[model samples]
Target chain A: MPIIVNLDVMMAKRKISSNELADIVGITAANLSVLKTGKAKAIRFSTLDKICEALDCQPGDILEWQNPAEKT
Target chain B: MWNKHRSLKLSRILVLCFSVMIFMMTFFVPFVADWYEDVSDGMGLIGGSVYVPMMVTLYVCEGLAVWAVAELHILLKNISKGEVFIERNTRCLRCISWACLLAGGVFGVMALWRFLLFLPAFFAVMFGLIMRVLKNVFEQAVEIKSENDFTI
Candidate 1:
């Protein structure tokens, strides 16, 4: 839960839609939605690799660890 | 070759038949107790004396038996639908286990008065333990399945 997915930010910066990114990464849009919404427990490295390859970004650019208590 | 579906269907039918048999026995309790006294002349007094306790014991056990069987039927229905390891099935198993324990407890108290009740009391305790174990297994499985589902 502390691991946050910034996928939507990256997608917006890259001007890519969820459906398009999902197609390029060979995953369903529902899974992309799960990743974007931070509802996924853990993302597979292969899927991460595909997402980075499609978005032209590093994993660090798409993922962040922010402690809720430290947000202030 | 017999399959799991067929086996479950058979179990459902068997439970239905047992429920019917229990229902019939409820109506025949008084007659059966009277006949039991008549069958053994020397033990007639003992039979007559135990009649009320016997009826109470049988009715209570039979009521629990109906409840347990209904729980089993629902559990089997869910399993046949490929819904094993769910919380509902675990709940059904829990209900069946408690029913067995309560029925066993009834017979156990009756055993204090008549030693003949010990046999059923022991059987119910063992059955309840088995069902409790099964419920625990199902609860664990459901937990694991949810964790797996969330790991995207």
Candidate 2:
């Protein structure tokens, strides 16, 4: 839970819908939803590569780490 | 191919027949003797030849179902972790496995009941133990699904 996916935030900043990203990344909308919601345990390198390429951003921009106890 | 489907269909029919035999045992075996108080008059007549063949066939069919379910679980786990991608999955297969487990348990209990009736209580406990194993596996399937949204 400490490793958070900031995909939705990044998607909003870049003005991309989850569906559209799913299309660009060649994955299903549901999977994209998982990543967006931070429910995914891990992301495949191939998918991560595609996502970064599609969004024109680095992986660091999409993934943020926070200690659970430090949550606001 | 149609031929492949035909062979699969035949095997399915055979499995169904075996299931029917088990069903017969569950229903009729009870009337023949109470599940427990009949306990040890050497009950539940599954005769040697019929018993061996039924056990073999059930073993094979159930083995296939178990293997498929296990593979499906693994695929689901991978999908959850994003290590795999799927176009679709076997919802039918999962449903069939659950049905098989329940049905198999019931028939086994009915057939064995006369031993405890001739032998019922301890037999039920044995069946309970088997049920627990099947339940755990089913739960693993469920965990894989919940983690994978059952079908995402």
Candidate 3:
């Protein structure tokens, strides 16, 4: 939960729609949605590779880690 | 041909049959007790004196047996529907295990009056222990399944 997915931000910056990104990433729209909404528990390296290749970005660009204690 | 579906169906049917048999035995307790008394008369067992207590114990055990069988029916239904490793099945197993243990406790107390009753009490406790272990396994499986489902 501390690891946040910034997939939607990266997707918006790249001017790609969710369906188009899902098509290029070879994953279902629901799973893409799960990633975009930060509901996924973990991401596979293969899936991360596909997403980075599709979005022309690094894994760090789509993932962020924020300390839970910092929120308080 | 025999398959998983047929096996589950058979298990459900057996649970149903056991339920019905226990239901019918509820009404036949007095007659059965009288017959038992007659048979035990020559064996030096406590005959007519323990009739009322024996009937009460038998009814209680039957009620617990019905509870356990009904939980088993639901569990089998869930498995037949491809819903194994879910929380509901664990709950059903827990209920069935508790029912078995409670019936065992009842039987154990009755065994003080009739030593032969200890056999059934021992078997019931053993069954309950097995179910409890199964429930623990299911709980762990359900947790892992949930983690896996959300891992995507």
lDDT of 3 by residue, B24-56 (tens): 999999988777655653322444365776788
Name the fnat for model 3.
Answer: 0.71
Judged by lDDT, which candidate is best? 3
Order of candidate numbers by DockQ, starting with the best:
3, 1, 2
Number of the predicted model whose DockQ against the real structure is largest: 3
lDDT of 2 by residue, B1-152 (tens): 57854655565566566655655654443343333233334445553223333344344435545554454455445544554323233343344445455545544544542333323334434544565565556566656756655222
Per-prediction DockQ, in order?
0.59, 0.21, 0.68
Candidate 1 lDDT, tens digit per residue, B65-140?
8899889889888888999878999999999999999988998876765666778899999999999998899899
Could you tell me the TM-score of chain B in model 3? 0.90
| Candidate 3: docking tier | medium
Q: How do the candidates rank by lDDT, highest first?
A: 3, 1, 2
For residues A1-72, what per-residue lDDT tens digits would candidate 3 score against the true structure? 789999999989999999999899888999999888888887899999999999899999999999999978
Off by over 4 Å in 2: B1-118, B148-152
In model 2 chain B, the worst 10-residue window by lDDT is: B113-122
Q: How far is candidate 1 from the true structure (C-alpha RMSD, Å)?
A: 3.5
The local distance difference test score of model 3 is 0.86
Q: Which regions in candidate 1 have their CA more than 4 angstroms from the true location?
A: A68-72, B32-48
lDDT for B5 (candidate 1): 78
